[model samples]
Target: MGNILCDGSPIESDPRYRFQGRQWETSMMDAPCNNCKGCFLAMFCPCCFAYHLRVLALEGRMENYSCCQGYLCPTCTSKCIPGQDSCPEFCLCLEVTLCENFAISSTRFYIQDQRQIMTDPCDNRIIRFNNCVQILSFVCHILAIFFRELRHLAHLLDLFADLVYCMVQACMQAQTHHELTLHPTAVDYGQAPRTITQQPTASDKAPLMGHQAPPAYSE
Candidate 1:
């Protein structure tokens, strides 16, 4: 009939409700304010939670909210980390001193000079980057030259191929003309021979035993 937890325990029946190391000694029915809800149930108002945390932060009372074992804003958090001690993680200002008001490091610490420390390794990233830039520059130069020369080379190649094709065509045409001509110009100019020949006359033939034949006809 009441609000139940995961283990089937009722909120009304649960005994221990601890907060801020203080125990809720009384029953829920007895303490009307036990479940007042929202910000009233919280340590401070939502807005005040932030404000108080900030105040604490400046005061340097907090190490962090986890040490408080609960959630607190940046203000109350700083308050929990006691002043004079350094918390490099949250210390915004690189100060040997502390203040709850400032957010960033306004103070300075003794940082060792790089010259005093060991020399740094040569960064290949910088070398590789420089080399890449140089390579790109060289490529760009080559492309520029290639673009200018490509058109001229193409034109020359086209002209050369055209010349070769024309020469080959001329040679082929000359050979064909020599082999297949109907008339041989300038060489065979004379007339062609006649088709028919004349026959000889009968009077022109002579007899072998001749003289006798003419006398018999007269008788």
Candidate 2:
């Protein structure tokens, strides 16, 4: 028995053996590559193109894929008049755009996090990555071969951390400490010195008006 077709007929007996049927023509794999404009449009905005393609596929209508038809619907509903089905399409487009924006923002944050992980030796990210790699190596021993090498690499990284610490310390020491510390004799224009006051001794006190002096006692 030769190859059998889906309709329970031999491939050779089928009239459309070589994809001559409409089914084959409509298939995604058989979609023509002649439309360079469509290709570029899809390439630039795959999400929009995919939504359009999905609509066309489900509706089985070629007219629905017209340029005027927005990504959400098979008609020009840009005005968004009430009682029209355009609201759903507009909401869908908005959702896709928002999701794409969020994905882009998340990717940027992930890239920044990765950069921080690679640059900052103090963080445990490197160690955690190394541990993850070693654990993965259990499933594939090719990584196990580099076990000693990774340890050496970790040591080198620690050395680099020490070097960075020393460099920071040297930089700090090289800076003028005079700028940070106050001079012992420097006058502060912002404030005035407080005057020192002391209580007068009894002998130093002058006699009050109308107050008689005490009689002196003999030693």
Candidate 3:
């Protein structure tokens, strides 16, 4: 007789076998302590707490995460190109533009990473660069009026921003390094490639000597 369990097994087949699979690990941090020494530190120094929070909730190494984003912000050093005529102002403008792109793109990357790990769908959507700054600024001012400790919330946000800024810079540097490694040009090499100047041969020099007068007869 053909077996009837073509796809998934019937629910009534077994009760003990279903519970044996490996458990999935969570990527979220636990709630901070309330009354202990840790809580005191967290309350007094929320920036440090946020750093710890980020380090904990993440699944893999922080370097890996930053490296992934770093490749996106490749560096363009036109000024360093060999023999290429590049104006000072143009290079300066490009550098400034690259910096701006790095900041904006890096912030976006951080926000996206945060969204993936966040537990609340609504909160994830609400937490963004512009929204975070504006909302937190307003909230900080209002809360500071009531709770004295809340004044530090602004500082916490600043610290977090600073951290992201540094991370973005790191990503940019890493990507630039990677790009340079991949394409080492003549300029990047110790010196620009030497041009082969054509040496004058006997035939070429004979023409020039043809017009010259004979050696002086004064012997």
Candidate 4:
């Protein structure tokens, strides 16, 4: 019992160092410089700064991180997407729009993406056309017939009225039919639309398209 107490004091201890048990020597390293809000916090790794920023972006706290909100360069300001450093100031991201439901009668706008929306009412033009068509159709059909039966034939007044009414009815049908043919979903494929130009001949020597030749060859 006496010998056991005297010699047992000599004991070994384990090291607290992380690299002590490892086969390879571990190197102590410094992080990269993270220019966050000009605080100049140098990071332990360049990879880590990006990781942190991405995490911040995903968490919807990009504004909280000064480094993320700060624009790195002009290119970043121009090209960055939403939730990114140098993102667009105000952005709109709409995947689709069915024009049939669009409405702009109210000043209020529905904001789904980063930007406010602009609406325009659909089918209103159809309503207007229907209203106009009803009035014109009634007058042209009824009044033209009445005029033919009541008015004298030698004067040819009734015939003229009938012709004019027929023209009006034909025009209404044609215009409405043309409007009905318009489909918003149909993509034009970038073809230059036909525009009527009251273009004078080259011999006429017009001044220009928009500018009027200020009363030339006049007193």
TM-score winner: 3
Q: lDDT tens string, model 1, 82-105?
A: 542454334333221233111111
- Model 3 Cα lDDT, one tens digit per residue, 44-126: 44334333332332322443233112323233232233222333233223322444433233322332232221122221222
TM-score pick, better of 1 and 3: 3
> Which digits, one per residue and each the tens of the lDDT, describe model 4 over residues 1-219?
334222212112201111111110111111011212211211222223223322322243433322222222324533443433343212211100111011110000111000111111112222233334334444444454456553233224334533433332222222222221231111321332232223211122101001011111111
Which one is best on lDDT?
3
The candidates, ranked best first by lDDT, are 3, 2, 1, 4
lDDT string for model 2 (1-219, tens) is: 111111222223211212211111111121223333444544466446434433433243333222223322224344543432434455445433554322221221222121111112112222223333333333233332445445445444444543433322222111111111221121322333232233222122111101011122222
> TM-score, each model?
0.17, 0.21, 0.25, 0.17
The alpha-carbon RMSD values of the candidates against the true structure, listed in the order shown, are 62.0, 41.8, 29.8, 37.7
Better of 2 and 4 by TM-score: 2
Candidate 1 Cα RMSD (Å): 62.0
Residues forming the 10-long window of minimal summed lDDT in candidate 1: 106-115
Q: In model 1, what lDDT does residue 39 have?
A: 21
In model 2, the clashing pairs are none
Kindly report which residue stretches of model 1 are placed more than 4 angstroms away from their true locations once superposed: 1-148, 182-219
What do the candidate models score in CA lDDT, each in turn? 0.25, 0.28, 0.30, 0.23
Worst 10 residues of 3 by lDDT: 205-214
